[model samples]
Target: MKQKNKKNASLAKLTQQLLAIDDSLTGCMRCGLCQAVCPVYGVTLKEADVSRGKIALLENMAYEMLKDADGLSERLDRCLLCGSCQTNCPSGVNTIEIFLHARQLLAEYKGLSGVKKIIFRFILPHPKLMSFFVAVAGRLQRFFRRKANKNMGMFEFPLLRPFAGKRHFQPLAAKTFSAKYGKINTSAAKSGIKIAFFPGCVPDKLFVRVAEASLKVFEKHDVGVFMPDTMVCCGIPNLVSGDYTSFKRLVKINLDLLSQAEFDYLVSPCATCVSSIKENWFRFRKDFTDGERLQIEKIHDKTVDITEFLVDVLNVDFTQSANAGCTRRVTYHDSCHLKKTLGIFAQPRKILKNLSGLEFVEMPEADRCCGSGGSFTLTQHALANKIGQRKRNNAVSVKPDIVAAACPACMLQLMDMLSQNGDNVEVKHVVELYAEQLTVNS
Candidate 1:
């Protein structure tokens, strides 16, 4: 009887803590406006899939008897963390912050899953181990990788087919961006802006060319480059998985590494990485040491998407040259982080619209989530594909020869959707498209 009372007391304590963490949700007002914007809710139509529904569940879990912890965690994980609900909320509820809070709280209560623990704890924090694994994976990729779509650059891992499902992905690169470039320290001859390059996970491993193109653009515009060696993965994957311990450790690693150097801005080809550094770093600021918090603030202020850098920082003249006569219809896909979070809409569009031989067409629902919420795509692929197919149809409806996005992750999803549908459209990073024009003009 005493032991039972002690257990109940502990459970009550945990529930109270969870409720305190989720108190930001009190602003929600049970508004159903989120249903119109939530990608998963649009597909599932389950009240449990939308933000209000999840908020109500969280409220219940905090106050009511403890029931299905696993079910609650799964419901929280159903979201893409895409910020659509927050963006659309008339009452201005911070749904992203609330959802992240719910995820962390529930994951703490239910405990991290086994597979996620290994990846988040052992694999992610060590850059050396991740690089070593990337090297080994790259070397062995050709053996397991079979071409699934040629133009789309997707492969099927037959050996890991059971784990990979029908999700076609670009094979790991033969060499990482760091391997090719090492660490570069170059001064601007004219542009005068110095940027520390963060070639995020996808660019570092799967799309080295995107990193290369970003470098090329910096050089062409006479912008300085700082490619630091000590960089690690941004903590988005860990944060999304609700593994705050790993997330904080990775943040410290990155903050320490970046503090060693000085630059005007930290530039990344990956919009998601920039968003994580800019917004999420601040969101989780309370968890850092005092000195680390200052560094996070300094670095956060300086992070910018590559598209924004080219047009805004370089002050690239976009008057549309007289000989800018040649044409191909290019539609731009707005990365949710870049668009909704940062309000970086016109800069990328201006970069695309200014391309000498390109005609920029706005795809319907251009700002829709590409369904690649980082790990969300890997875990919930069928639902992701369903959302991605909508994005794909919108891009193809414009009959664009090229679909451009500022995010590599979005590029991957767009490729999969377009390839699976046998569409002739090619998806590319907006920076890559801009880089192509720079090279031709040069």
Candidate 2:
């Protein structure tokens, strides 16, 4: 009887907290503009899958008209949180913020699952331990995964199919980027600019070559690089999972490590990490101590996507005519966070266009979300694959020899979509293509 009473009290407290965001919830115009752009709604064709539907549910719950928080959470989880709806909303509803906060509130009310608790709290916050596990998985992957496509670096894991579901994925690196090159601190040369490099978790572990390419670009531009061994995951995974405790802890860890280094800007090859540092970090500034908040603000100001850093800050010229000597055609995919959140669609295209041997072709709907919303691909696998197939169809429609994206997560999705179809197109980062040109010139 006492336990039941305590549970009801906790539920009542959660209801009160939900009411706090009522003003933001009321901002949704319900004009259904989000339906035009929402990738999940496009796939599911369900009202609850769109932002407006979710907002309506939130409003009802806040007003005590709805008692099924779990059902509402399921509806919220169906979204990609790609910020597409928010970007296109007529009323400028803070869709992402409201969804994220609602998720956090619901998570608190229901408590995190054991698996998520382990991943967000224990594994992610500890870089070395996470690295050790990935390294082990890398060695054992060959035993479980058979080569699906050699050129695309894809493998089919029959053992993981129950969980992963016909997913073809890249193998983990034998050595992460940080393990290979520990803690670099170089002075600025001809460019007279210094930057702290944040090779996001995916690039560091799954796509070391991309991380290497970023370094080569930095060196070619004469920009100083500072990469500390201490930096871990950028906390987006935690934040999106509604594990605010883990998210704040990860942020503090990164801020403390980054504060030790002096640089003109903090640059990352991952669009999500750049967005998290710039936009998401500031969203919760009030929760931090005064000094921590100041640090967060400074870091937020300094953070830039590597493509943006190159073209905007370094002023690298990409205007040269395409060489007739080489004829590899490349198409660019605009990542949602890169384009919608950061407004960095053009800089990557400019970099692609300037490459000596590659011809830059624009893919149809290049700015569409590739459906790899970080963990969204994992939880909502079927919906993610459906949305990814649309992106795949758009890429192939351009008939390019290679498809490139500024974000590593997009590259992973593109690789999967193209490889599954046995398409002959190569997937690469914009920097990798640019780095090849630098090598040719050097």
Candidate 3:
């Protein structure tokens, strides 16, 4: 590999790597169809705002039309990388890969912020230290947060306003799931299949009860579960931020933890974790040694989103008579990782449909990005909130008693959006609903 030129990195080389985007880009045909589906482009009509425009920009970079590396990076980071454009693209260009690689290159050049370096590098790697901080944060949340909007779950932190901005957020959990439930080994139920559960950081830390609900569901099905005492972050947060090195470390840690276990499938309530393990690991697995690579492939092969596992793997059935006088109308929001990345839009809905007393209503644009792109929300909050408002509107339009999603990060975002909007819609994990349906007698 040539030394990456601090001043004049070859745009041609960068473009060549980008163009080799798994033939997904080959299908794009420079179609402008993505422009209609892009939320950022919807907000900004700049040619660089749409996927076609960005693809053109990258192509121009290959031919040397776009210079100013910083400017190009800014344009690249503008994307939510929601895969909305790829899903909508007539050519089916792998815009997600292009933007992610582009961001990595730019971050390598421009360098990450000191805060990011500290957070991703130091904190995220060590779940124990991270849990401690979250514990304190949860205890002190009331002192720091002032009601920003009564209905939207919006809160303002006067001290951290400069960094966090005026937006609402859920308070961190006092105890992370990993801390509370160190390791679990449950016997298979009548189904006679075992799975290892990976709840990722957000669900484990912020929404601990969701993980509990998952355990409950597994017990109900008589499905066994294996959870290692120590699991690392899922690495999507590190990967998307252009820190492949840290991402690799996290992947290795997770693989090492679960590699010693015996389970039929690796499961997660988090769509991002399932996709990251199933997809991104393979995409970057080449960097590892043969031994590690084999382990990576094995995990990837076994990985399944929780809903997919419930509906597909265990053959859980959701079609049943609705509970008489069931009053709660629940709606499902498809996390982009589940719907777009893994093509798992229906199974979650199917699981939601099974809840006896719950009315499963479909929201408009049920598959749109909720703008909780992990660190994307933290860094580009204004843009994130703008995208989230659209999601909030769709959910609100349905007037759901509660909102359900496969990803905890999406639940966090939905909770904030609904809270800020002053709507009282509770955000619940799909597994939680399934757990509730388990016949205690069975």
Candidate 4:
């Protein structure tokens, strides 16, 4: 009887902490406006699937409709937390804050799993260890890889079938970008402009050629390059996982690495990393000391997505000289972190639209989320695929020669969906397309 009482007391305490987040959610106004913009709600139609509904469920625990703490954690993980709901909210409910608070509180209560603790708390923050794993995985990729889609540059792991499903993925690259070009410093060819490059982990590890293509464009345009060594993750994976400690650690590490560099701007081929540095870093800079905060602000001010840098800063003319109606038809997928979060839709399209020998076709709902919400896809693969298939259908409807997205993570999900569906569409980064069009000799 005493033990039972103790357990109930603990549950009550957790419930109270979870409910405290509701104070921040008071602005919700019970408005269903979130439903119109929510990607998960649009597909699931479950009340508990939308941000409004998730808030209500958390509210229910305060009122005692839910009692199982574990079940509540499961419910909370269902959301993409893409901030679309908050972006569309008329009352300005701040759904992202509420969800972040709830996730933090719940993660505090449940504690991260053993595997997750090791991955997020340890491996993710350590670049050297991460690079080692990437190298090993790259070497061992062929022994376990299964051919899933030939044209899409994807394969499936028959070994990881139980955990990864039968989903196809791009095979790990034999050499990482960082390994191929270590601490590179390139002088501007003739354009007399320079930028620091950050390819993030996936591109640096799995999509080395994408980074090469970006560098190719930079070289052809006479843009000087500053590629640094010993950079950490951009803190997106950490932030999304509710591990703010690790996230801040990575941010500080990256700031320390780039603090001594000289560059016009810090450009990356990744949309998520750019958005995180430009937006989220400044928002969370309060956690740092004033000196640290100012440094973060300086870095944030200079950060730009690669496409944005090309089209906006460099003023790369995408107007095809004579191949405006080129034979190759391609469609673009707007990454949620890129289009929805950063308002960087037009620049990538302009780069794509200007490509010679390529016909630009707009996929229906091109701005929709590609269901690759970083770690969200790993935890919630079924829902991720359901959402990704919607994106795949939109791409197929256009029947384009290829699908282009700015983020490599989005490329991963799109490859999985397109590969599984037997769709022949290829996936390429926007820079890859632009790089192909450049007259190298010019």
Candidate 5:
């Protein structure tokens, strides 16, 4: 009888948590404005794939439809979490927060899958352990990976086909960024500014050149950098997977590291990393102690995108250079997180336009998502490719020499789309293009 009472109490707690989204979900007028912009709904054409339909599902479940918890979790996973729907919604509904909170509640009630449990819990929080695994995989990958596209630097492996499903991926670096350069806490050289450089996992591991290019720009501007080896994942992946425990652990780890360092700013070349640190960190700030909350607030205040930091803080300029009119046609893609979530749409474009010789062409729907919502690509590859096709079409329509974006994830999706279509147009980070014009030291 006592055990039965305990079980009922647990159920009651889970139900209460699941219903927490009721208030936010109520803001939805069910006018279906979200249907017009939702990437998943665009491809699937199913109501459940759209935000309003999902909200209705959640609302119904709150009232009585509790047996379909698993079904609800699957429907929620269908979303790209691109914030496109929220950006287009007239009601000003906070879809990102609502969906993320809903996912957390669902995970708590239905429990996270076994594989995600191992990854979010054991694999992601420990940087060194994860790095060790990546190092081993990097060493062994060459044996399995065969070149898929020479232009894009993409690879495929027959043996890994079942898991990756013929996906073309950028190979991991022989040596990670941290392995090449140990802790960097230097005094400012030219700009008299100091920063904590948080090179998120993608740039640190797969796209080292992006981080290197960012460093060149920093060196040119005389900025001091503080990149400790102690930094872990930005905790976005953990939150995306609904593993709050791991996310909080990673946040505390980063907070402890940030507190130890003294810098006027925190910068990342990756847009997702910047947005996650500035916005999502603040979103869940209540999870920390008073002291940690203060630390988080400081980190949030200091963090900025690399382009935003360069042009705004250091006063980067190119008009005075010899190659002020240097001639290359380029179009820019506004990474959804940077442009929509953070409202950082203009700064990157301004940097591109001001490039000495680069002509900045505008792509159609410049702010539309490229559909690379982290794990969404891995889970829903076909749909991702379809969305990429649309974005790729818009990019090539301008006939630019290069398609440049601020986010490496966008670059990855662009590479896949362009490579699959056999288009010769190059995909690169905007910072990479800007770095090419900077004077590098011998």
Candidate 6:
């Protein structure tokens, strides 16, 4: 009986923390505008699947009218955290912030699972250990995976299908980007700009070519780089999972590493990483010490997407004469975070347009969510595929030889969708396309 009272008291405390965001919750007019843009709600069409419905649930939960915390957690989990609904919201309610805060509170109320606890707490914070595991997995992957599509570089793991689902994914790289180039520190040359390059987990571990291509572009333009050997996951996965303890640890690890580098700007090929550093890191500023908060603020101000850096900062002249003989049609997919979160749709397209051998074609609904909302793809694979198919169809309709994105996560999703449909279209990062032009011109 005493234990029961203690548990109730704990629940009450969590509920109060959730209620603290009442201003943001009450800002929702319940107009259902989010349904139009929400990818999950678009597929499920369930009121509980959209932001307004979720907001209503949160409101009810705060008022003690909705007692099913498990049900509320499940409903919240359905979200992609794509920022689509928040972007399109009429009331300007901070939906993502509210949902994330609510998730954090709920996760505190009901502790994280064992598997999640292991991955988030134990593995992610240690870059060396994560790399070691990935390296081992890379060596043994052939035993488990069979080629699904040669054209898209996708594989099927029949044995792991029950756990990983019927999906074709890219194989782990033989060597990670960090393994290939342990650490890089170059002096700024002709461009007179130096950037701390953050090749995020997917790019570092899986799409190593994207990271390499970014380096090529940097070298060609003489933009010096400062990539420490210490970078880890950007903590979006942890934070979005409502594991603040792990999130803070990862952030601090990165903060300490980044603070040691001297650079004019911090750049990354991964849009999600850029968004997380630029926007998401500031959300928990109060949790850090005064000095750490200042570092966070400085880092936040300096972080820029690679495309944004190339086009806006470096001001690369894409106006050079186009190679009329070599025209490979390329369409751009605006990553949700790159566009909706960072307003970075135009920069990538501008870079794509300027690439000498590529003809930039705009696909239908170029800014639609690819449904690869970090861990959202893992938890809700079927729903993610449904949302991704729309994006795939739009790209196919444009009939481009290649589809370019500014995000590694989006590239993974695009590769899966294009490969699953047996489409031969190549998926490349915007920087990869730019780097190809740089190679050709040289």
Q: What tens-digit string does per-residue lDDT give for candidate 6 at 1-442?
A: 9999999998787757865866578888788888899889889889989988888777766553247767777778999888998898878988899989988887886788899999999999888898999999999999998999998779988987665567789999998999889989999998889999999999999999999999999998898999988698999999998899899999999989888878999999999999998988988988998989999999998999999998899988887845454578999999989999999888888877776778888999999898888777877888888999999999999899999999999999999999999989899998888887777779
Each candidate's TM vs. the true structure?
Answer: 0.94, 0.95, 0.90, 0.91, 0.94, 0.95
Error of 4 at 372 (Å): 1.2
Candidate 5 Cα misplacement greater than 4 A, ranges: 1-9, 62-65, 321-326, 440-442
lDDT against the true structure, per candidate, is: 0.84, 0.88, 0.79, 0.81, 0.84, 0.88
Residue 281, candidate 3: Cα error in Å is 0.5
Clashing pairs in 1: none
**For each candidate, how many residue pairs have backbone atoms clashing (under 3 Å)?**
0, 0, 15, 1, 3, 0
What lDDT would candidate 2 get against the real structure? 0.88
Evaluate candidate 3 by giving its C-alpha RMSD to the native, one decimal: 3.3
Model 6's alpha-carbon lDDT is 0.88
lDDT tens string, model 5, 1-442? 9999999998897767766777788788889989988888888899988989888887866543376877777778888889988998999999999888887777776688888888888887777887888899999999988888887778877786665566778888888888788788888876778999998889988899999998887787788988988689898888987778889998888888877778999999999999999999999999799998998898888899988887777776655543355577889998999988888877888888877677889999888888788988887777787888899999999998889899988888888888777777877887887888764313
Ten residues in sequence with the least summed lDDT for candidate 6: 60-69
Tell me the tens digit of each residue's lDDT in model 1 across 195-278: 888999899988888998998888888888887765888999989887888999989988877776678999998989999999
Model 3: CA > 4 A from native: 1-28, 60-67, 148-155, 439-442
